[model samples]
Target: MELINNLGLGFTTVLTFQNLTYSFFGVLLGTLIGVLPGLGPLVAIAVLLPFTFALDPVSSMIMLAGIFYGAQYGGSTTAILINLPGEASSIVTTLDGHEMAKQGHAGKALATAAIASFFAGCVATVIIGLFAPPLAKLAFQFGPAEYFSLMVCGLIVSVVLASGSLVKAFGMMVLGLLLGIIGTDSQTGLQRFTFGIPELADGLSVAAIAMGLFGLGEIIRNLESVKSGSMQVSKVTSLMPTRQDLKDIFQPMVRGTMLGSFLGVLPGGGALLASFAAYALEKKISATPEQFGKGAIAGVAAPEAANNAGAQTSFIPMLTLGIPSNPVMALMISALVIQGIEPGPAVISEHPELFWGIIASMWVGNLMLLVLNLPLVGLWVKLVSIPYKFLFPIVIIFACIGVYSMGNSAVAVATMAGFGVFGYILKKLECEAAPMILGFILGPMMEGHMQRALLIARGDVFTFFREPISAALLILAAVALGLVLLPSFQKTRSTALVDED
Candidate 1:
């Protein structure tokens, strides 16, 4: 009954003219971003973060959330129609999706992806509404020690799950922690690493860093490898799937949704991991595993469902615990902070409208995506043919404009440029920027919590162990780190991350 009333309030908020319009535009732009290669939700959200300041918190969140999940819908379009993956999570879709296109079942593959995504998105939204409140309630029990320990656990989990060298990920995380402390000391009223720069007093702009690393850095890399050619788009004859197709995909979609929903709640697990894991599961279980790369419809259905489900449920931790599951959630946390709302357990109690409105908008947005993806299939395919040379300059200009708009600071622009080069270098070294971003976002909060806990305990370092919850969290962190260091686990991790390409 409480859930019903809350959902009623949510629909009322989302059904407003302004909020609906923003949601539509957000999903539309997200699909466009997904249809185009070399761009992702992180870059799009970062580029638009500054502009969202003008909107109300609820409206801004509604739109941004739309973009995140809507990308899942659009990514499959490129994966099916062409061999390219528009988003990292869509990479698995290309294996069977493109094969279906080659066999002249392009329309069937596209339909399967859309239907599976819509179903998973709808189910995941309900799951969020059902589970988030209890999680938030549970978070209310956390003390400073527990909070700090939880962050330690989260960071360790991110390191364990990160693709590539654990040492490199740890190094990047430490670097981010160092960068995060570059401003003034909150307690001492003195500077730490300002180096006499006035702008450093307020700390580095998250927008500037995010835009530079993801937007500008990606553009520069894409430009270097830009090919001059038009892509061949598969022609869509029928958008409708056969009755048998629906029956065949229903179980895979359900299984994928279940798997993704569980994984999405874990630290460092999101759509990319969920999609790959889902495809692997389906292939392993199938009686005719040989047909997996030969246009099996289950391949299109499962991963599409998993990715979309993972994308939506990834909000659980961010909204409830203030811990980000991925870089995109880190940005969402920044958005909440910018809106003067501290993200965590208090979000639901203090701002019910914002919480429920965003949840309701996910369902509405998925319906819109289902409506949009089918008819506009041709439009998306046509968008793929646009040359990268033309798009790269535009992306760079927008990134610069967005960063500069924050307080009109040239120092911020310069900061972005520096990070762009730094990001490119990290990419060249096969390092991921996600862990660094997470550390940067969490470092200050973790430091603050630890300080408060120590002060309360009369400077006793063992206070963390005295608290059962904190002790458990720290133990979990140690176990996670220990498991990742094992030779057998390392081999398994590498094998699981191997891409079809």
Candidate 2:
């Protein structure tokens, strides 16, 4: 009954003319970004952050969130049509999606991705409406000890969640946390890592680091790869999935939704991890495992569903706890802060309309994606043909503009350029930037909470393990760290290494 009332209220808030217009535009632009190579949602949202200053917070967030989720639908279009996964989450789709395209079933592949995304998005949004308030209430019970322990858990999880060497991920995360301390101290009136750069006093702009590491980083990598050849594009067909296709996808969709919805609530698990994990899990359990790399419909369905579900559910942590699980959500939290909205447990009670309205807008946005993706996929395909020469400059331009617009400072531009160079070096060394970005996003929160917990405990470090929740968090962190070091797990990884002939 409570869920139904919230949905009704959500609909009322989303039905407004202003929100509808922005939602539509958001999905459209998001699709455009996803179809283009080397531009992910992180860069998309970062590049667009400056423009949101002129809009209302709810409207801005609604649009940004739409773009974040909508990119999932758009990304698979390229993964199937061009064999280029527009976003990291869509990489799994390429195994089967592109093969299906080659067999003249491109339309079915795209249609399946779109429909499953819509279905999963709907389920996730409804779940959010039902669970968010209770979750918010639970969050209200967290004291500094709980929050600090949670931060420890998040930081430790970063090592396990990272793709490469655990040591590297931990090193990068520690570096990020140290970098986060560059500005004026929150608890004291002192400067730490400024090195006398006047702009450092204001701290590094999230926009600068994000745009540089993700946006300019992509440009640098693509520039190095400057390929001299092109491949044959697949011919698109009917956009409808057959009955058999639906039957094959039904179970995976359900499983993906359940898994992603739960994991999405975690502090560090975002759509990218959810999508990759779902793909891996589905492959492990399928009766026809060999069909996975050869255009299995479930391969297209499961991860696509998981990514979309995770994308939507990721809003829970940001809204209810003022903690962002990913860079994209971090941008949303920043937007809310800029609007003078302190996002926390009390947000639900204080700004019920904004809270419920954003929830409502998600459902509406899913509908908008369905309408937009079904008939307009061909247009998205056309974008794939856009020359790299014409495309990259625009991305670079938008990136520069967005960074500069933050406080109208030239320092931000220089910061972006410097980090772009740094990101390029990391790319050259084959170091993954996703973990770095994740570290950047989580670093400050983890630090503040750690100190708060220590302060509240009056120098007693053991208090974190005294509270049940905090102890549970600590135990989970310990187990995660242990598993990552286990010899058996390490052996399985080595056995899977590709052997060159």
Lowest summed-lDDT stretch of 10 residues in model 2? 492-501
Q: Per-residue CA lDDT of candidate 1, range 1-501, in tens? A: 999999999999999999999999989988988888889898889888889999999999999999999888889999899898889899999999999999899999999999999999999999999999999999999999999999999888888877777889889888878888988777678888888989888788877888778877887788788777777778777889999999999999999998888778776788987898899999999999999989999998999999999999999999999998888998899899999999999999999999999999999999999999889988998888888877778887888888888678999999989999888888899887877888888888898899899999999999999999999999999999999999999888878756533
**How much does each candidate deviate from the true structure in C-alpha RMSD?**
1.3, 2.1
Regions more than 4 Å wrong, model 1: 499-501
lDDT of prediction 2: 0.81
Residue pairs in steric clash, candidate 2? none
Please, what is the whole-model Cα lDDT of each candidate in the order they appear?
A: 0.90, 0.81
Error of 2 at 41 (Å): 1.2
Candidate 2 per-residue lDDT, tens place, 221-251, comes to: 8877756556467887788788998998999
User: TM-score of predicted model 2?
Assistant: 0.95
lDDT of 1 at 75: 91
